[model samples]
Target: MLKENKYCCEDHVDMAFDDFLVEKETFPCLEKSEDSKCSYCNKKAEYVLKLPS
Candidate 1:
């Protein structure tokens, strides 16, 4: 069981979520990142992409 997570900024969350859907074959659960940074642009992450382990 591997837990996967990706932090995305508001600007790129849509694109990142789209990719996540394609990869996971289902929607990812969105959460607040708090202090996490975006994996794409390194901006302060506003969305956290997570899937069950």
Candidate 2:
């Protein structure tokens, strides 16, 4: 898997999820990382978004 994107809030999660779902068509693995920023915002990321490689 690859850390495709990072999300700080649920609002931004849906867009990433939809893109992932369309690309992979499966549930993704989740993780949390340190010092990572949200892919769609300036806030620090709370959830690590992984996409199957």
Candidate 3:
């Protein structure tokens, strides 16, 4: 599944999943805003995943 999505094994799956959910909630603006940054890395859209269609 990950291979089909072009995700590397080292990528954190959980983080990617969370990013996907966020993206779905906010379609046009997939980047995490100042109010919605990752607690661990404080990065916006760093660990993004392509949701399954």
Candidate 4:
């Protein structure tokens, strides 16, 4: 499903997958300071967790 490709938000922004990986690799388990929005749609993301573990 979406998890396989590393998508988090309901909108499934392309950058979400890449951002998740970068965040995990660089700063695992770190909390996000701000909300994330979908790049393609420019809407508020609906990710279960703002920051991926």
> lDDT-based ranking, best first?
1, 2, 4, 3
Tens digits of lDDT, candidate 3, 13-32: 46545554564653222232
Q: Candidate 1 — which residues are off by over 4 angstroms?
A: 1-3
In the range 8-49, model 4's lDDT, one tens digit per residue, is 455554466557666555422323324656444656655423
lDDT of 1 by residue, 1-53 (tens): 43488789999998889888877787788988899888889999998999854
**C-alpha lDDT score of every prediction, in listed order:** 0.86, 0.67, 0.38, 0.45
Candidate 4 Cα misplacement greater than 4 A, ranges: 1-12, 26-46, 49-53
**Candidate 4 clash pair list:** none
| Residue 39 local lDDT, model 3 | 37
Q: For residue 33, what is the lDDT in candidate 4?
A: 24
TM-score of every model versus the real structure: 0.82, 0.59, 0.31, 0.29
Which scores greater on TM-score, model 2 or model 4? 2
Report the Cα lDDT for residue 18, model 3.
55
lDDT of 2 at 19: 66
Off by over 4 Å in 2: 1-10
